[model samples]
Target: MQKHSSAIWTGSLKDGGGSLTSQSGVLSATPYTFATRFEGQNGTNPEELIGAAHAGCYAMFLSALMSGAGVVPDRIEATSTISLDPTTEGSPTVTAAHLDVTVKAPTDEAAIRDFAEKAKAGCPISKLLKAEVSLALKIA
Candidate 1:
């Protein structure tokens, strides 16, 4: 299970712009610049990509957990917000990740909470990230 993405940058660090391409071509030539990363400009940034992956991973993992317990969910909505802050060494660090999840399931409150806890701890992305991970689950 290996995925790859390539990036090409030109010019100086602050003034340089780059394109990102993934093996699946989803991000073919997707533009990123210093402004996008540091100044909240209009373009994709690394943090945003990480958030996307985390959100997607959490949603899928939750669905699987629910299904395995014979409690298939009707819907699962998840959002992952990665907290990026500067470290003492003047480098960006992922300090934390907040996952907001809403699930529409036909199950008891106890079961839903149990499944949510399991998924939050068992998600592969959660294990990969060293930062603190917090999950908020809403049942509907």
Candidate 2:
């Protein structure tokens, strides 16, 4: 399966603005701009979107891994923090992604840790990103 999203930008980098749309229509003409991205304005940005995607992918992958191991999870919460370095040579670079995860499960902590590590390394988003991926997991 394939997924797609589009962005349209107009004007210079500092003065320009753009809108993003996804094929699913979930993000139809969502606004993003220099202020939103670099100035912390009230709008969406690419790093925020990447964080959402990474968190969602990690949660789902962890659940699947636990299920495959015959342990059903009660709950899994994942938060991804994407670090962007604007001082990079040509353009800003995403330096790393840190995942903070909390899991409530019927299994032991050791099993949960094993599955989480596997998911962290094996998730599609994790593999797709070139940045260093690190995880901090808590079993509750």
Which candidate number has the best TM-score? Answer: 2
Error of 2 at 123 (Å): 0.5
Worst 10 residues of 1 by lDDT: 131-140
Residue pairs with backbone atoms closer than 3 Å in model 1 (clashes):
none
The parts of candidate 2 lying over 4 Å away from their true place are 131-140
lDDT of each: 0.89, 0.95
What tens digits encode model 1's per-residue C-alpha lDDT throughout 1-140? Answer: 88989898999989889999999999999999999988888999988998898889989999999999898999999999988885546778878889999899999888888888888898888887865757687785
Displacement of the residue 64 alpha carbon in candidate 1, Å = 0.4
Q: Which 10-residue span in candidate 2 carries the lowest summed lDDT?
A: 131-140
TM-score of each: 0.88, 0.91
Residue ranges of candidate 1 with Cα displaced over 4 Å: 131-140
* lDDT value, residue 98 of candidate 1: 93
Per-residue lDDT of candidate 2, residues 1-140 (tens digit): 98989898999998989999999999999999999998888999999999999999999999999999899999999999999998999999989999999999998899899999999999999998965757687785
